[model samples]
Target chain A: MTFLRDTATIFSREFAPVWRDPLSLVFTMAQPLLFLYLFGPLLENGTDTPGPAWQWFVPGILIMMCLSGPLMAGYFLLLDLIGGSMERLLVTPVSRTALLVGRTLKEFVVLLAQAVLIIGLAVPLGLDPHVPGVLTGLTLLVVFGIGLGGLSFVLAIVSAPGGELFYGVTQVVMFPLLLLSGVLLPVENGPGWLQVAAAVNPVTYVVEAERALFAGRFLDAPVLWGAAAAVVTALLGLHLARRRMARGL
Target chain B: MIHARGLTKTYTLKKTSVDAVRGVDLDVEPGQLVAFLGPNGAGKSTCLRMLTGLLPPTSGTARVAGHDVTTEAAAVRARIGYIGQKGGAGEAFRIGDELVTQGRCYGMTRRAARSRAEELLTVVGLDGMFARKPSTLSGGQRRRLDIALGLMNRPPLLFLDEPSTGLDPASRADIWSHILRLRADHGTTLFLTTHYLEEADAMAERVVVIDQGRIIADGTARRLKADLAGDRLTVTLHDPADVPRAAEIAAGLPGAAGLASDGPRLTLRVAAADRALPEFVRALDAAGLKIDTAESSRPTLDDVFLALTGRTIQDEEA
Candidate 1:
């Protein structure tokens, strides 16, 4: 009970500034919105994928947001660590897990809101709605995001008091994960090695699952693979980040 | 409310290890304002972090506010407040919201936290600035906000790491007044680290001096000064030729040490300069050595450190 209360406290604190200004949330969504309108139409004639460009590109955009959004969540934690606020929070009686969970919950909320906005905008662009399927796909994306957010927090804690390591690691890791995941383009037409690499990349399974789910193929093999990948990532991210929090910065 | 034994912390890098705090043992009674004094990298912050349950010790044990810092860290954290070296309020958050969040972190209800935040803001003289961000505040105002956040829970003990460092003289005094008032009103046991020798000497009831990761001296500032660094009595001789004889005569005085002579000026340390100055003068006068001038001065805390380590704290800081 206390853990939940502490988590709520942290969540509220993390969310308060966003709730106040809200313009910042729009700025974060700007990049995804740009991709949705401008680059998304470019996929109309270029791809041989089964569905309209909106259906194919929208879920990919949501997955992309899930990737970048939660993966960058640690930057705030890094700021707290560099400042004295993190130390202040650590000295309090608040549960340590609550600290990580609370911040991650805030990231989840923002991701969900942004995902909904992106989906709503893509609907007018001739995207058909798969209500339950999209909801389930969002659930999977959230699970994956929680894990990515957790890993990001671990990176933040490790890079504290200087923060160079956090920036360096995130920059070095984000691009490869995004490109390899096939969120923007299909890897099926690529070389055998590239296909093998995509097969191994957990993000590729998530993107595949998202694309299948958005097209209402809930029972597809990619859905199971993506679910497994999401669950594993969430578990690993939460475990490592929680352990790091327990061990102290 | 605090006790520690054999507390140690060591950082092992690639090929070598540095002992940040080595075998520190400390005890503090309730409501005592003890100043932990040291130069840079003297383990003051490290010790504070351990006692506050923010950092685990490399070895040994500490019980702060009746809970083991390692095993019962939650209990320890609950019973103590720690204001770190940096601004406690997040720059992106409003000061009031941060204080209320701090209160909530300690399990206070939202309503209670809000009221306490308002009350503490007033107490710290930041009453009307609740909605402002920390970055907008002046250095001293930001420090006061940090204190307000630390006091949100009203813990029995508060550990402030260099509370008055880098502040102007007027602001330092203002912070001291708030700290002293907190102790006076609620009997908050303050264990604060400080670089200002005069602040520690004037404000703290007990002083614990750490040097090179070890406690070198701990006592009342008066006791440390009188015991380690005695008063100084200097005399200017009428002739530089009489300096050696004056030094010999000054050395013969009771409780005299650190004797030195340069040219016509002769100086020596004594337990009480009042008693030793006149005796040394009479001896010199009887030896047919005329003295041009004589003066005696009491030693400061810097002198105590110098007497103990052969280097002044200011020199070490430099």
Candidate 2:
């Protein structure tokens, strides 16, 4: 109970600043909207995957939004490290796991809002996402956001010179994961090696699940796999973040 | 409130190791204000970090406020307030909010934390500036906020790492006055690190001088000065011709050592300026040399440092 209270306090602490500066919120949402509006349309007529182009593209855009939100969490952690804010909190009696959990939950909340806005925008653009499936997909996206954000926090803590190392390494890692996951393109019709790689990518399962849910395929194998992938990613990410912080972060 | 034996910290770099603090033994009684004096890279900050449970020592052990720093770090942290070299308040929060939140971190209820924040703000003389952000506060004001944050829990012992390092003269004096008041009112034991020799000389009841990761001298400033660095008497002759003759007469007297003349003036290092000055004056008068003026000066902490280490803190800094 104390852990939850402390996490709430930290969450409020992190949220208040971003709330004060609405420009940060606008900027955070702008990039995903730009991708959805600009790059999203270019793929409209290209894919012949037996569905409306918007339905096929919306899942990728949703996952893209999820990835982008958590990817920036590393930068926030880096700022806290450089600014001595992390050290300030470390000296306090607040639970170490509470610190990371608080920030991860904040990112999760923001990512959920972004997911809602993306799906709402898609509905008007000829995308007919099933209500129950979209709800389930949004829940999975929240878990994925926490996991991804937790991983970012870990990267920030373990890496020396947290800023450049996190950015450089995450950029290298994120692009490969995104490409292999078929967020922007279908891997089914691609080369056999690409398909094999996509099969191994955890994000590929999430993207496939979202694509199935977007087409109103509820209670399917894709949903189970996507939810499972999100849960595993979340567990690993949270555990890594908490363990790193526990070891003198 | 602080007791440590052989507390050491060694940082292992890529292929080599640097011993930042080596086998330091320290003890401080309750309510005693100790000024930790050292040059840069003397491991003062590292020592403070170790004691406050902010950093673990590489070897040895310490107990701060009755909690072992290594095994009971959380207990130590709960009992002591550490104001780091850099102010601990974050950039985003207002002064009152920061203090309140810090109080909550120590398990205070929100109402209690709010009241404590108000009381501390008044204590630090920041009553009207509660709404101001930390970044908007002046350097001295920010330090006061840091102090307020540190005092949120009202710990019996407080550790301030260079509290007045970057402040102006008036601000430094202001900080010292508040520190003294904290000791008087709450009996908070203050163990502070500083670069200012005069601040330690004038303020601290006890001064611990560390050099090259070792405690070279530790005592009251007066005792350290009188024991390590004796008083001096500088006599100026009426004419440049009288300098060597005055020096010769002064050197013959007891405790008048390091006698040297520069131009029309001659200086002698002596044990006690009060006892040695009159005899030296009589000797100079007996030598038929007319004295222009004479003055005796007591040794400062710098002098003590120089005597102990063969290098002044300023020289070490350079």
Candidate 3:
């Protein structure tokens, strides 16, 4: 109970400043919103797979939004390190887990808000995903955010004092994940090697699950695998973050 | 309140090892304020960091506030406050919010934290500035906020690293007053590091001088000055020709060292000015050497450092 309270305190501390900066909040949602409006239309041309353009595009945009939330949240940790605030926090009685999970929790919450905004926009653009389906997709993204945000926080610590390396590595990893996970296009229509790579990407399960939900196909294999992947990622990412914090960042 | 034995820290990078702090043993009774004096890079900061449980010691044992630093760091931290050279307040936070958050980190309730923040602000003389952002504060005001934040947990011991390094004289005095007040009112044990010789001499009851990662001298300022360094006597002869004869007489006196003649002035160091000055003057009178002016000055902390290490403390800092 104390651990949860400590985490909440840290979470509020992180959230308060971001809440005051509406412009930055708008910028966080801008990219995914743009993709939903611009590239989202290009999907209307119809792919080799059977699905409406908006249904396919909505899931991809939601995943894209989730990817950015944690990546950007990592910068806060880097800033804290450079500013000596992390050192101050280290000397306190606050648990290392609370310090890490608190920041990631803020990222997860932001991703959920972004997911809501994207889904709200998608509804007017011909998105017909049902209430349960949309709720499930948002839930998956929240869990995925925890995983990704935790990894981002860890990466920030790993490349501390020189954050450019963090950006470079995240970009290298993120682009590949996006390409292979069928966010831009269905992996089945791609080359054989691409299919094999997509099979290995956990995001593939998320994208597939969300796509099925967008099509109103609930209670399917995709949803189960996606939920499992999200939970595992969240657990693994949080665990690594806590371990790195304990060893000193 | 503090005890450490053979506390040491070594850093190894790319097969090159640098020992920042060599074997150091220290003990301080409760409510005693000891000033750790050293030039930059003298391992003063490293030792403080280890003692406060911020950094792990390479080899040593430290018990602060009844908790082993290595094995029970959280307990040690809970019992001590550390005001680092750089202020720890976050740039974005309002002064009050930062203080409250720090208190909460130490497990204080929200109401308790807020009320304590209010009291500390007044204690540090930052009463009406709670709503201001930390970045908006001047150097001295920001340092005071750092002190208030450190005290949020009401720790028994406090460690301040160069607390008044870059402040103006008035601001430096302000910080010193607040520091003394903390000790007087709460009996908080302070272990601070500084290179300012005069401030340490004037403010600290006990001064520990560190050089090149080793404790070279430790004692009360008066005792150190009287034992290691002596009173300085400068006699200005009416004629430059009298310097040679005066120098000879000064060298002949027992415990009169560092005798030098420049122009019409003859200067030398003596163990005690009150006893040595009278006899030296009578000898000069008998020699028929006219004495224009004679003055004796008490030894400063810098002189004590110079007497022990052959290098002035200020020189090392420069």
Off by over 4 Å in 3: A18-24, A46-50, A161-182, A185-205, A216-236, B236-244, B252-254, B261-265, B274-279, B291-299, B307-318
Give the per-residue lDDT digits (tens) of candidate 1, residues B219-267.
Answer: 9998898899999998999999888888888889999998888889888
Pairs with backbone N, CA or C atoms under 3 Å apart (clashes), candidate 3: none
The DockQ figures for the candidates are: 0.88, 0.52, 0.54
Predicted candidate 3 versus true structure: per-residue lDDT over A47-148, tens digit per residue:
644577788778888898888888888888888777767777777878778888888788877777778777887888888878888887788888888998
At residue A90, give the lDDT of candidate 1: 93
Candidate 2 per-residue lDDT, tens place, B24-48, comes to 9999999999999999999998898
lDDT string for model 3 (B122-233, tens) is 9888999878988888889998998998899998999998899899999999999999999999999999998888999999999998877789999999989888998989
Query: lDDT of each structure?
Result: 0.91, 0.85, 0.86
Model 3 TM-score, 2 decimals: 0.88
Off by over 4 Å in 2: A18-24, A48-50, A158-162, A170-180, A187-201, A216-232, B236-265
Among the numbered candidates, top lDDT falls to 1
Superior by DockQ: candidate 1 or candidate 2:
1
Q: Pick the candidate with the highest TM-score.
A: 1
Q: Best candidate, DockQ-wise?
A: 1
Model 2 agreement with the true structure over A108-206: per-residue lDDT tens digits: 777777788788898887788888888888888888888888888888876744377887888898888999998877888799999999999999999
Candidate rank order under DockQ: 1, 3, 2
